[model samples]
Target chain A: MRSLSVPSSPVRDLLALTSRPEVISFAGGLPAPELFDLDGLRAAADRALTRRTLQYAPTEGDADLREQVAARLTARGLPTRPDELLITTGSQQALTLVVTALLEPGSVVAVEEPTYLAALQCFHLAGARVVAVPGDERGIDPVALAEVVERDRPELLYLVPTFANPTGRTLDAERRAEVLRVAERSGLRVLEDDPYSELRYRGDAVPALAASSDLVLHLGTFSKIGAPGLRVGWLRAPEELMPALVVTKQAADLHTSAFDQAVVADYLRESDLDAHVRRLCATYRERRDALVGALAAVLPEGAVRTDPDGGMFVWVRLPGEVDAAVVLRRALERDVAFVPGASFYAGEPDRATMRLSFTTGAPEVIREGVRRLGEVL
Target chain B: MRSLSVPSSPVRDLLALTSRPEVISFAGGLPAPELFDLDGLRAAADRALTRRTLQYAPTEGDADLREQVAARLTARGLPTRPDELLITTGSQQALTLVVTALLEPGSVVAVEEPTYLAALQCFHLAGARVVAVPGDERGIDPVALAEVVERDRPELLYLVPTFANPTGRTLDAERRAEVLRVAERSGLRVLEDDPYSELRYRGDAVPALAASSDLVLHLGTFSKIGAPGLRVGWLRAPEELMPALVVTKQAADLHTSAFDQAVVADYLRESDLDAHVRRLCATYRERRDALVGALAAVLPEGAVRTDPDGGMFVWVRLPGEVDAAVVLRRALERDVAFVPGASFYAGEPDRATMRLSFTTGAPEVIREGVRRLGEVL
Candidate 1:
């Protein structure tokens, strides 16, 4: 118990490899720097600071940020009230709060075979027994999830249904409905982590699982859209969960940055988020295709790649018994980096798998990075 | 267990009461808004946003902020190394991380009998058995702490030695030394929470426990000096505890806001924090005296108050069997608000005690606010 850790996040380890100026990193799920609303955010920061907004905020968050977050979700077809939301440091903190409030030590938590690695870290730290439910290119398989619920009786099912981290897979509408039905019937809590839905380039936007299920705890973040630097996010949970979540959030950091929240609120109020997202979608879309096409053209014939419709990553299953660490080591020498997919699994992982993010680099850089990775392989 | 809260922080509850425009609130230990280095911070924000400082910072914090924090401590006689520190979302999170890393369920923690109420909540949520060591205006009794250490075999002792919350007490040099000696001898870790140390008004500053003891974990925050709304804080822990704390912080919020930290670093680099603090002290000192004098003139006989040298609140012990809740109810009727001291205790609390902050109001407002409370009494 003394050597306690929330498991070493191997994805962050992957990010460390990108320190050199020559490194074209596909390892981190960073947004394109060029797409950031820097000028707008600068003005927003100026507005926030001048209002003497440097005092402590309410534990829930600044009211305007809450309303802005609520409005954004409402625009995305999820009816949300300001009272129903709790602003978090990021969705990362919202995840931490939800788990701390809802899960006891050694509680059973079910997750997709490959899910957000950071969420896995949070669960592991809380001493939750995480059972992986098998998933495919289109997100977690509903039948497998049902089986896990039947066998393990998990208290919670954590999902990243729309453009999930690592996989970049969006759960189809039918699967979303079935999963929600299973959760509602079983009285199991479902966490709908939706950080990437709005960054879509091609596919039709699927309504969030939270929209359909009362059991769903929806997490949304400005990290991907506004700026990760501000560290702002929100959780839309059932009223029942609010008390515990609030208490947990209060202890975690007292509150997220009121100054940052005010800046975000100002930015959200004044700027065109949809237009900005569309631009991000366009930029990330080209980079996504470049990596997929490059991996297809460069890697061996037996290598399988999931061509994601949108979002940050392309999941690759390299041919044969290839070790990710070895490939990563070789890739680093050539100034190219991608996270080993083994890092995403709850237990035993496929050593052959890798996650390549396209959001951090240009299309040509993506092609070059992939070409370098192919040479290393 | 389901209604999990760190503890019910009445200070936050007090802030909620301040929403009414007519209420003269002395319930929260908030800073003077007018004293904030707003112009400097505005420039810092401009500089921060200009440098593309809107990216995920290193888990510990931005390098420059850590160095600045370290340098500030070095000036205060604590030889802090940049590597020894982990920047937190505020010292609140520093506490959360330290407890998460060091404590297990049912772990014994010895705290000052009316220590920070929110610390109790964090300990409670972590399932720690918080044993109280009796304290007075001179701060926690070191002899009582040693006795608790002997009988309870507690793993940690949490103290706010200088300008402690609720009591507005400063532990003397001899007491600080004795406490450190006992803690080191007992192999009990000491958490020296020092948010208000820099807000000195009347007395000479006390050197921190961490400066004298290797067993100490020091927490410092910019909230009291720089800005609470920014929510930046740091932990100076022994290298042995760094790993677990780092992991806990990573799982907690990934890291404190880089954008905020960068702004703070820039502000620290550019401005004189000492000058700002001196101004704060000058402002608060006058208000503090006003409240103390007003209470003397207005309160019923037998009411006792601590005339603090520094920090925010003045703890008042109301006459006889006066229920604090009742006094607060009546105080609200007169549009005067303060925290009933009953909210600060771990078990059954002192109903006759109250805490009033002089930091928020001007001298006239403080005098008027105290008069209204006197009328209510």
Candidate 2:
């Protein structure tokens, strides 16, 4: 009875390893502060300082904000209704609500190998066992996912189709269509977490898998583009699923902060969120390019790194003889940090792999951090 | 699978009954708009609109806000550490995190006969069966609670010991001690939810039940006194429970909005929150008096209402022949609304009971709403 019913994060115990202030972290998926639109926030705050903005808002969200989100989705070729969207504390709570409503104890869920640790945590807490499907640099392997679906008949499959965490891989359009087709055939509900879609550093915009499949639950967030401090995010699901999601949300946090929602709504209504997103893409691309170039110049010949089209991270594979955990410790002594690849795995940990975030620090800092890592190696 | 997993809210389902624009709603547990210090909010926004305020913050919350919460608790004689407190989206999220950690399938929980509906919803969603203990007008009856505890030995007992929802009842100091003793003897963790503690319309302040027992988890909110739009709340628990709550919160919403936390911390630091509380007390007291007076003049001779010292609601018992739900429907038809008693109870609802909220509307609105309700009756 003393033990919690929810499973505790094993990563928390290992948190002590990276807690020192001197540790220059690439471990966390934190957005760059310089990329945040501070001037826009100030302007938004000025608008929200009105008496009406301080009042309680509709639980669904402010209608104008929902419409803004809908418009953004529409621009991306995914038509959405205000009623189909539920604003959450963050995309994390969106997952929490979806999992709470759709999952039961011992329910089977399929996740990509080296998935987002936080999503894995949510699924584990909901009493679901995660089945890892083999994925490659091109994102989830459709054949492997189909095999798992045939074998386990999982209730749901979760994926970050664009700019995946810990891997920094995006599914090609053909793979996206195949994954959607397989899910539809197997009757699997797909949770498409797309927090990084707008942060694309290169390439043409890809249509969401949700646009191709009615069963897909699409998640979006303000964390990557704007500020994580606001904790504003949303989920778009089928109409049949909206009521349950709302109820689960009510049980979770009643609703996201109304004041934050109002500020965001005002910002979206009056400002150029797209232009802000363009700035994020431009700055992050430079940082990404710098990190990639620095790794090429500094790392040993056999070391390999992911070439991400967009988003914050660069997943690197070190020499098999050198464990990432060991490298992380040595790097931290040189005042640098990265997430060990093991933190992202559902079962089998890849000791030689690690995730480095390139978006949080400046290009010069990234170069210096990589040079230090090279020295440690 | 869809039907079994999603537990619908009966209250929210019935919200359509009072959805008309003309309705003077006593159904919502919202604070009055006039009571909001717009001037203070404007000042706070101005101060918090800087570049630093728009950046990401620690998941636990900003240090200054945590210090302010600790100070407020210390002044109340409840010793709290800044680390022990995790700022939540609201006290609602505080309860959600507690339930997510503590409850599993078939777990037994105890509640007052007519408890806060949201708590019941949360517990139910967490896969717990709530057993109601008979409570008198003064709050959870110590004798009945002890008997239920002896028989059931539930995992936790949730109660609003001060100015409780649906009942507007406060537990006396002696009863609070008795509850603590009973809980300790029975090994039942007590969740003391006290959102309305600062809204005392009359009498001196009573120490929270958490002050009497180390096992008690205290939930406090800024919604009643300051602004619900900010959605800031806190929980103080024993050291052992802090880790589990924090971990659960990490999965639920990452953390409450950091911007809101900074604004609240800034507001509290620069101004006397006590002064604002005094204003709320004065405004709400006038509204309460108006409702009480109107009920006396308009209600039937057999009608009875609790005389609450503080808080938003006044629980009323109409003639046994008159069903509150039916009367609520009639009242809504006449452009007035309230929560019917049936929504509050987990087992058999008292058909004669209803809850009238006095804090959201003005004195004139309250008077008119009560008159309309009386006319319908």
Candidate 3:
């Protein structure tokens, strides 16, 4: 048989470095299942198993679920209609649809430096050049973004305004408005990814960047709040973009699973998702405090760690000479794991930084893991 | 906000003309949901709910279901391993992974002239130009494929080997082997789409082209036999290609819904899927026969219809002057529907052809729809 050279994913090459069994991966931006509403999901699935719910549903999504999502977003102060919402396989697929519909080969997309790796991968696959804007713990630096927007004339900018992956930082409300204003002035559309917004452990809820920007494409998912197993997520875009997204989604997976949608809808209807969110906040806050306290106590002086108010991750910067990738291997030898900070950057990766997740392990496990990390250091 | 002009899907312009509610959509290659195993699905969902199977599962799929799918394939004389399979949101996403991982911008792909529209959409989205090879009712003509292979030196050939969409055509054993041989000699990879393979209403089972071609990436789905709403499908690729696919899938939706995968796995293990297939065949056979019989009785003198041994669709060609799109509008005006032929082609679609799906509606509905179509003619 002849050997045809198949093209490979640019992102896939990085995956092999992180796929070891002994690696306690903080690399994957996966929701910790210990925090999932398994009881509610079970009840919802039981309810959905009835004869009426087992058949094919509308390709758009189950009507009741779409309405619930819309209502929830409306309550969050965003103007949304049920018809405007599209349920997707995940927020990941939603991003894929956005990229597929709005991006062409060689299109310029401005993203946050050290943004979500998956989003970067999606844009790369869609044949877009990912131009990064410098961001801090408060999210995208409006001045830097404005400079890049004026310089590169990018078509879109992607950001996570609340508790971003790899860096558990939220963009402040002032910066949010500034970013929106800049986008309005510069003609750049923003893709506001807010999956970690609901998992906030401290402070009051902040309005999403989408609420402020008319040009924003808001992506949300149930993966963090409820269950990742269902792979249910939604996108709320402007009228002009919805049709294109629908068509792109139709060509992607027909639509998200109807069974999963129906079950999630049923779960939302009967359960107090807000209350579940509160419980998640309490538990994750405890875990977060444990890790932060342990790191402070165990790590050497000058090993800076991000003090995130909420979300699953903590970004840490080590001494300039200590590469995180090498540290990760040493930590694994001591039976601990984390994602190297270099994996998160679009262009110039930081070898001295790493991300630690507080959601996956228990408080006891967190302490032990940190102690092991201290020994490695 | 400034209107951003990103390059759109080339097929998007064509989609507007095709999505009219009044059009008899032979354009959408949707499975006949009437044949789905709703009872078994309901039972499985109920059982899974009781077992609390709504939590996150391994990214590959639920273990029992993978084992069951493997066992079932093995029973059919095809060797498979549970680890070798990756459950996808649908066969569409499965194909998307293959395209994303293998095709680069401007890569050459060979496809059937009248291919599955979604496959064309996928390849186009991946930034590859599709070269069409002429095909007859028995699937892609091997001699024509060989000629195209020699001329274009394409990277991949995509085909629907059994009960193909829009055509309801199956490749005989000899043709299957010949096509595999051609692919081997030419060093071309083949993507064998077999979603409709199990919906056969008559005749003995034909060996899959994958069994013959080691280069084949075989895709299977539960939509035709089980439920489209479940969105459960699997792709069997060679070991060398599996990692890239897994990485692509991880970037796509993390994985297909673990809840849905669990239910499907449980359903496949606990229920008699073969018995369900038998039931589907019996009902669909009647529906297919109804449309075939009605067309024989009512079609215009010069019109020709396919006599498919199995599958839900029957392709029909009208007289030279009659365009199927016009006929479709007229049929829908009379409260009937079918898809126009032009939507299926990757290049120039046949304006004189149309496809009628018999299994989506009842025999009486099928007869009435065909009668209205004939009247329009």
Better of 2 and 3 by TM-score: 2
CAPRI class of candidate 3: acceptable
Kindly provide the TM-score obtained by chain B of candidate 3 when compared with the true chain B.
0.91
Candidate 3 lDDT, A225-315, residue by residue in tens: 8887788999998877876777678777877888788888988889999999988888889888988998898777778888788888989
DockQ of each: 0.65, 0.61, 0.41
**Which residue segments of model 1 deviate by more than 4 Å?**
A4-7, B4-8
RMSD of 1: 1.5
Candidate whose lDDT is highest: 1
- How many pairs of residues collide in each model? 2, 0, 5
Model 3 chain B: lowest-lDDT 10 consecutive positions: B1-10
lDDT of 3 at A286: 89
- Write one digit per residue (lDDT tens) for candidate 1, span B1-377: 25544345666777888879899998877888888888888888888884356777678889999999999999999999999999999999999999999998999889897878889889988889999898887788989988999999999999989988989999999898889889888889999999999988886778888999889999999999989999999999998788788888888888888899999999999988889888888888899889888889987888899998889988999889999989899989999999889877866688999988889899898888888887888
Q: What is the interface RMSD of each candidate, in Å?
A: 2.3, 2.6, 5.1
User: Per-residue lDDT for A47 in model 3?
Assistant: 75
Candidate 2 residue-wise lDDT, B240-303, digit = tens: 8877787888888877888888888988888788999998899889989998888899878888
Q: How large a fraction of the reference contact set does each model reproduce?
A: 0.69, 0.64, 0.47
**Cα deviation in Å at residue A242, candidate 1?**
1.0
Can you tell me which runs of candidate 2 are displaced by over 4 Å? A5-22, B2-7, B13-19, B50-52
